[model samples]
Target chain A: MGKVKIKKKSTFIDMTAMSDVTVLLLTFFMLTSTFLQKEPTIVYTPSSVSEEKVPVSNLVTILISSADKGKVPEGKDATEAEGKIFISFSGGMDSTQVAPVIRGKMLDEALKVYNAQAKDSKKIALTDAQKKVFQETNMLGTSFEYLPELLSKSLTEIDKEQGDMYNPNTGIPIDGNKDKNGHLNDFQIWCRAIYTVSKELHDNMATDMGLTVDEAKTLGDLYNAITKDGTGIAIKADKDTPFTTVETVFDNLQTMSLNKFSLMTALTSEEEAAPAKH
Target chain B: MAEVQEHDSGKKKKGAQKKMTIRVDFTPMVDMNMLLITFFMLCTTMIKSQTLQLTLPTNEKVQKEQQNQAKKSEALTLILDTEYTDNNLPKTDEATGKTVHNVYWFAGLPDTTFQTNLLAKESFMGDTKENGVKVQQGIRKILREQNKDVMTNYDELKAQWKNREISKETFDSLAKKNAADSTLTRPVVIIKPGPNTTYEALINALDEMQINQIARYSIQLPTHTDTLLLENYQQRTGETVIRPTVRKSVVY
Candidate 1:
């Protein structure tokens, strides 16, 4: 028999097509995926049955906190024995304390903006002739020190306890006398702070930018112009804070301007188990 | 002759000799594949799994219904104040002298001066009467008044329905119309029981509202902002915030 040989065929596949498709899918997802920014930690929220949906356009955030133990009623007794703290104003105490705090925080933010502007203008010293113009303007001389002191005093007053003298002749704490007035005092301080901050910022901007305070006021006016159609103030209180405090903040904000405002609440995945009562 | 033949043979041999080779360019193919992948990737929508955010009402709807009568007369405002007491002892119905027979009914009734006065009388009776006849009578009276219009409308529609003269759409509309009109007259009951108010108490109120056929109801609670402020106050002062234990109605 004659000798014979058989040839074998080799099989191969190109993976480049599959790799290209996978890469395309990966790129698409990467581009389209939304990454949410980490939101602030929220400790509490006041409850309401209002179904009114607040718009996101106009918002001024207010932070609120309660007074210390000495400020609340029955604090000394409750603390010593049962480790309990009782607010003097019942459901409304927290609100009273927060009104002033918002005012203070707003002032602080305004002052920070003013200081930043002042420092930037100072970097390029004015010419001898320009210095006279600047001196006449006195824009650089504005001070924010007054704001901090005022805020501190307001905070102190809010933290003060109701006095025996303020108690009614019947020896029971009067509902409308010192305690009620005290609550309003915080609100007044907030209003005053807004006035002060807005005034200061407007004046300084006018002097620095060589515009009138009225022109400087345009900054707030512009902000209002943009956010005016919707609710004005946006308050975000810690979750653990009392509902009274947040209410007070809202009340103060409402009084500041007729413009509508909203309260922001942080939503969480885990349900808040009701607080354990004594 | 031999030279010419040899030369011709050499030329023929030279002409027969040749070299063959095959080649393919891969650059354009790679580029095209990449471009196709990019286009597909750009057009495709990525699947996203998201957690639905929800705000659950903390106030008990039935309880709110039992507390204030003014809510029915005007725009109802429900304020829920929940307190957790260690004892878990059910709250005494300060209005009724007798112990609550049905938790649902107790929770659903409006917390009004009338209800309170009735309860006070029942409590005074001190088991002198069998069952809560007076309380049942008071509830029935209010329910009848609230539902009078709707009940009448329902009867008219039902009669029309029996006649087989009305279209399906008209019948449905009539039924819905009757339901909505009746619902409006009925006050939204708000229960602002302290946390110590037992689950049994809350459930009883719910049952009562359901039995009374009160459909439009909402459980109220402090706003999110209020809760946050409370937390902040506690942290800053290291003090416990004491909320009011009283349940009162304000006419706004």
Candidate 2:
């Protein structure tokens, strides 16, 4: 039997085509990517047939925590963690009033409203450093009483405490403090602050940006966003959350006269009509 | 393709330089690009969330005289509730893997006397096809039946848009105008979500309103009469309806 010799070949594979493909994909991703906003708790918003897209800027996101269906500490109710509200503000990118500036103004405005209604002993006074920290916070959930302490902590500690749903001091208190002119809850105070601050910025746009009210309205600035069109405020909540929990937020908004708002939802196609059963 | 090759002349000359081939290995470039793509994929949100615009009437009490009353013949009410498991998690439909949303609807002012089929029960069955024809099922069927005029016009407008006879903006404005047309016989829907109703169920109800092209609808808390109707329906059907609140809210 004659043995045939196999020719030896190099074990190298060409990566030029692979490199070209990856580069093209990387370019596409770099151009189309929008970084996911860091939220303390995750929520799966309900799906709807509504086609309106959430505005990119000049928006206030009210995030409500869902029940802890995951791990729960012994002897603790999972529902206790539900309904914690966090507020995040996004200002227009090109506007003079960016996120940090608007946030700083919101802190001042919230404190003013809270102090106006709070008793002398209950009043909150934040240090300059704490105020600076508050300005950098993307999503804030603590009540006014805990705001100073929460802002004093390091970033890691702040995140840890905020994620701890059992912590009584974590969420913005949404108890039944409904009188608009009188004592308002921390959630109400935040809403009032947002409204007042946006109005102030909208009025100043005439002189500051050299735009008329009509022009600013066309631009869909923060002022027109919250007041006129109602697309500015978005309520993001877990789909499985109880109606009563969402109703609490709605009731508070209604009491504050922010009757118009949008609910965040995933897109779903309309279901076809059902067939008749024989 | 990745290598730069220098070809040498066959004829040898004195003082001729040697031809060298330069090869470029693209493995590292591919690796770096893959790492970048992974990073971008993980950090980015490709599907932007949509928004359903909602406008609630102000909480301030409206004067009774100023309140507009719907004609009794053109009123429909939907009460929403969600099923839960023993562990207090929302119960899902085994077939579709979707949360089971229970909806109870009644026509006109709640028939406290129970003289008619006061509160009929329905789930969000969506739709089904029979003989290649689409038909509405569940609560959607009832709502669509009530708002037939508006839906007829809406379907025509939709067909026009689909056939490229009208632009999307024109179709949208025309459909909106048709939905709000006062001359059309439209049903005024009152959505009353029970305490146990999930937010998804409420959204489903709102979506039905949009789908049916119903112009006037308002969300209200379930009244005592509504509770009575639910209790009566439960007694007649022998289905356990009003359970204690599964998840107590944090509200004081």
Candidate 3:
């Protein structure tokens, strides 16, 4: 009889298959991913059955901060933190009107309008470095008087300052500054600045492309994006927030003649009232 | 599959040749790829948010002559409100896990004297199935009944689209035209969200407009007449419908 020869197997794992799968997954994510824009606060938008998709570019988002219910300091009321407005602009897909460039131009135009309408003490004068910071900011939420100092801070400092909901200077002042009241509020000033800049950009693009207004309308131009298609300005508010909080934003938009806009919502499906099968 | 092997014939020559096997280890590569995937997954927003388009009449006041008034028979007003908890948060329904939103509706004009009891109350009950047949419930049912003329045409168009008889684009354009068809009898909806109403309640009301295919709808703040009707309803039903505003306006 022969002694049983024990065989030793190599202790190795062939990771080729694992690597292949992971590479495929990585590719999928890289191709399909859109980086989330950084905002000062997060809000859960109400869901709706409307199927219209938000446009990918040339959009202005108005974010309304909800009340801080969970963590309130000792003396302050929770509702005092509600209705703070923030504004962020996203430019077109093309290189000419990318976010940074559009933001820089908007700053210049807004400053001009604000300084013109604002009282001497309320005027905002930003240096070139501060303007650069403003261009890089994803969402801006400070009153006109506070803007010069807010933009001068470092990125982390700015974020920390704006994240404090109870800060008196944290939000853009959006009181009832009606158009018929003779002077525009800071919110209206921003709206007016956006309107002027977008109109100018649209006209310039139309002339440069040698396209007529009708042709530009078909080409997804800025004018159509803002006014005709009603997809440019989007109001994003929390689901649980009261209607009066959101209505103030709507009233301001209406005052600025931005009668047509969109509301951001998550998608949900409900059965149709019809008896037919979907 | 990762190993490379070379074979040499056992022949004596000027110099003996040695066989060699080459292998590549992919363990580190897999680890790095996993790390990258985690980063992308955390940083990416895969689902785009949906949008509902809305158009409000200009804030500028319009003269009475320029305003196209709806016929009294075709007018339907909805006053929306949301119940609030003692903590000032919106009170949620325990059964459905949805916030409690109440809809107070009246047809034609508000009867201030409460002689007709025209102001009826309804909640947003989306849909249900009874005895194997689909049925609409609550406020949706009422609105759909009022807009049956448009809904009938809409159902036909929807069926045609589902059967592949018409393209989606064609179906959409036709459906839009049918909704705006002036000849069909349609209800003119005025959605007045109360001060205590949540934004979600207002959105639900707007979504109803889209789902029911009602073309003429406008959002307006509640007037004094609406308040009077609510008070009457409260007195008759013994329901505490009116409350102080939960949100305090922030003034700089």
TM-score of candidate 3 versus the correct structure, residues matched by position: 0.93
Candidate 3 docking classification? medium
Model 3 lDDT per residue over A1-278, tens place: 99999999978888899999999999999998989999888888888888898888889999999888668999999888888899999989988888888888888998898888778877778899999999988998898888988988999999999988899999888877767346887788888888889888888888899989777667564557768878999999988888888998898889898889999988887763211111
TM-score of candidate 2 restricted to chain B? 0.92
Best by lDDT: 2
What DockQ does each listed candidate score?
Answer: 0.05, 0.54, 0.54
lDDT of candidate 2 over B1-252, digit per residue (tens): 888978666367785766867778899999999999999999998988999888988878789998989889888889998999999998887766788888898887877789984888887767677898777889988988899999998999999999999999999999999999999899999999998888888888888888888879999999999999999999889999999988896555
Task: Show where candidate 3 strays beyond 4 Å.
Answer: A1-7, A272-278, B4-25, B250-252
Error of 3 at A148 (Å): 0.6
Clashing pairs in 3: none
For residues B1-252, write the lDDT of model 1, one tens digit per residue. 101112233345658634332223344556666776666555553422111111222122237556544443522322223232333222333544222322112223234333221111011111122474323333333443455565566657867888998876798687766666744565555432222232222322333333344444543443453344444545556654434432221111
For each candidate in the order shown, give its overall lDDT on alpha carbons: 0.34, 0.87, 0.86
| DockQ winner, 1 or 2 | 2
lDDT, candidate 2, A140-258, per-residue tens: 89999989889999877888889888889978988776678877889999999999998888778767779875776776677777777889999999889999999999989999999
What does the lDDT come to for candidate 1? 0.34
Interface RMSD of each: 17.7, 4.8, 5.1
- Candidate 2 backbone collisions, by pair: A273-B128, A274-B127, A274-B128, A274-B135, A275-B128
